[model samples]
Target: MSAAPNLVNLETVSKAYPDQVILDAVSLGVSAGQRIGVVGRNGDGKSTLLKLIARTEEPDSGRVVRTGGTTVASLGQTDTLPDASTVRSALFGDADAHEWASSPRVREVLGGLFGGLDAPSLPDGLDSRIGVLSGGERRRVDLARVLVGSADGRPASVTEGADLLLLDEPTNHLDIEGIAWLAAYLNSTKSAIVVVTHDRWFLDELCDRIWDVQGGSVFEYDGGYSAYVLARAERERQAALAEEKRQNLMRKELAWLRRGPKARTSKAKFRVDAANELIANEPPPRDAAELVSFATARLGKTVFEAHDVTVKAGDQVLLEHLDWMLGPGKRVGLVGVNGAGKTSLLRTLADATEDRRPAAGRVKVGRTVKLAWLTQHMEDLDGSWRVLESIERVAKRVQWGRKEMTAGQLAERLGFVGGRQRTLVRDLSGGQRRRLQLARLLMAEPNVLFLDEPTNDLDIETLTQLEDLLDDWPGTMIVVSHDRYFTERVADETWALLGDKRLRMLPRGIEEYLERRAEAKSDSAAPAAARAKAPSQSTIDRATQKELSKLERRLEKVEDKIAAVHADMAEFATDPGKLTELQGRLGDLERERDEIEERWMDLAD
Candidate 1:
């Protein structure tokens, strides 16, 4: 294999703010085809590092070197598209249909993002005014323009195929399917990508490396998010051990550096060992079984129920005749397309509407259900108030399970430290404001939480803390979020709002939801002639069809069993012997499932 060429480099880069140092003498390089994920707490130089590399902002001391003619494209946290321009003009400038239509990459980008220029979501199609679009629509347009890289009507291959892509929160407004499509699209491209996002799943799916920015320095890691986490734990453990042995800070640092002769050679093995040791020594973040038991004791049986409920936004029926039951201590994650009414259902269940009315049916809440909604809007907050004041206004002390936390303690956990709690809400950044909102939400101590897009503007560290807090929360919770990692981490089961006015539980979770969406899109887009050429089910022998159905059922059972086995492995991760047993069982189950899948494919063909 050939080595990837370096595309960009930062030499001893140092950047700082008036109040704090952002980066200090950090050196890094971006090689061709390197997919890197940047992670840290908010305001910890993540965006600064991207800006320095992109040369949008100069480092105070060091230099950023880019290869000659290496075009760099970036999407900031906010939209930078001209509001006066139409989507067509914004994407391809004066290029006519013939110019862009000939480019397969352009077409794929269009199809994947905006549904091939003919989607209903674009009422005027490409001619839609940028100013008239919603925030999410605008975000998608900006992203498409950057990905297309065709303002001069040239093909993306000619303009951006091997260029450097610096995207900040590119997945902010994207749904799960959109995110999946983006990961696949970026992987297929030849460009070197450095993306700053809180989406852990995206990082794991796309990145070949990770950069952890903290305390004014960047610590490099070898692999994806999961690998970075493992390596980081090991690094911290080595630091801790050095401190313990030497009891001297500088000597401890030196000791850590000199501890391992083979560390440089066997880093991967070291990380694997670290994972095993950490799993065995550390307790699970939350006790799911205990939380459920506690929740049942507190909230009795029912949390919320909807019978024949219908919800509409203007003339569009978002949900229809939906019937759902929310049991005590259940945690559910709701997902769908951008406008698929996940939020509307949340509102209905929480009875947040002005008139307590659903378009068709009724909602019932149990007497013991104390619901608190963490909405998407930050307008509910008083900008004049300080962070601690805002939290204290809700309650000075909140009960989380059996433990009681003071306002300051809650603030600290949510990332607001000593002086930060005193900072006025008006002066806080977007991510800080979000943390404040969550702190306030928890102060209410509701047994039922309806969290709408709670992961927005939160960094990976804050997200980890939030997930940890939720683990101990003994409550019935419903969350609507685009962040797949957070959803899978916090919710026990997944459901989808498929625009059929029905809330469907996904037995196989979000992956099943993605598959259903893909199938729907494929069915809609199939050519009539292609559909007609396929053999009809009635033409097949009834017995063979039955056998195929039987095979499918068995395959599903085996796959579910495989998922169960994996979960069991996580539970027994601390025990080496038990993990080895589960690993063998998992291997056997996977082979059996693969055989069934192959048989089904052959029969179908």
Candidate 2:
């Protein structure tokens, strides 16, 4: 018999920098065909683990074992393509056989990867240099290389052979169609994959498991992103309960020892001594409580208005003939492809000084509208300033009444405790900087808040906290984010910028909008064969029956697990270390049950 494959196994892994420990005694196993999503806040060693597994970086002390013939590839944050390489040449090179380029299988993969972009005929030939391509185009080129694989050594027929594939935010620069295509491709691949992403919808759709790296250790959950979230919340709840019980027991033991008279029996005295020792040695829980709060100020009835507005930057039109009105407590989201001038429109609206002239239109603002803007680049902050000092300065400049509190106190409230408050702004991680910027926003107490890419690099916990804060926000808010979950939760309406300086307002959520766009695209691009083979009513009925059968089978399995919670708990009690394991499993089952039921209802409809 062939030896079993170990997709990934790390033994006694330990990695450390000079000043901090990134991972300590961390061990994890990923089996074949498993799709795992790795998540953590910035600077939590998530990327480091990926590097170790891909052999890009080595662990300080540990053994990383990969099964025989396993191939792994990682798409890192930075593009790894050469400067002068074009998309086609980057994938196949100049000397590769032309037949491979014309292959139907190759064309299919290319079409899926690039959203049906014409692969055969290029405006510029394959010899065209990559230096001229835009950022988004470059990313697509690099991704195409990976999808095509090595052409010289391996025959072009060798496709779908990736044993393991790692992607770090593959959807970073993709548009809606590109993202949909990428999702479908990943789902269809047989590769065992690990993805680190902030996109919750992508994670929910692609990953089978979640590996959360936190506090120098990894927590594994056998479910997708949503299941991981519920499991984590439940674990925190259990931990709080456990701590409370321990405290109560300690209090009771201390009271008994103090109240009892000198015991006549030696056994009673010994027991009292042991109890005191146990109480004295008990350690506090590792995690600290955070007092996170964000409240928005009230605004006037008419927040802002724009009439025949045209925004331009250096003679280039960003938005033309635009008319908009903002009301009190309105929540809006702005979305567009990269370089589509979303940021330019925002700048024109937030132009307080009127230094630059508007392009052929008028924009109006309410007299009492207090606006605060969070830019994507974070240029307003000074690198020399300490984290706490930034918050203090914002509070003082805004003339907020709560300026009496020390900088330390403010920092603590924003989840920056210990020596982190004194850390220079330049030293903070991406997530920390974002949080500090948010802290400044809270201090200003703006009636209208404009946030750009607010969820970038934020962990699930921070994202949850932000969602809660925004849910209760009283201000008229406008946000620009590609994160579907954030947009769905916070946005009441969406403004999508189409080409030619045009904007369309969509009342429905992002997912609905994407679905509609997909349908429209399909309707517009229907092939002759598809039209000819249009299904009859009977055929449609048969297809629906088949889908319903599959849905019913899935629902039945989910129901069976829901009925076996007691059995799961009994199995959980078998081992002391399995307590956490059991809790995670139970959470996964419950979430699956809910999702299956929802899907079943939809299928029935």
Top TM-score hit: 1
Which one is best on lDDT?
A: 1
Q: Which ten residues in a row have the lowest lDDT in candidate 2?
A: 285-294
Stretches of candidate 2 off by over 4 Å are 1-5, 94-99, 102-109, 112-126, 131-135, 150-158, 241-297, 310-321, 337-341, 352-361, 380-382, 396-415, 500-502, 519-605
**Worst lDDT 10-window in candidate 1:** 245-254
Off by over 4 Å in 1: 118-120, 150-162, 241-274, 314-317, 352-357, 527-605
- Over 398-493, each residue of candidate 1 has an lDDT whose tens digit, in order, gives 888889999999898788978989999889988888898889888888888989889998998788768767877999998888898788778889
What is the overall TM-score of model 2 with all chains considered together? 0.69
Q: What's the true lDDT of residue 387 in model 2?
A: 89
lDDT of each: 0.76, 0.64
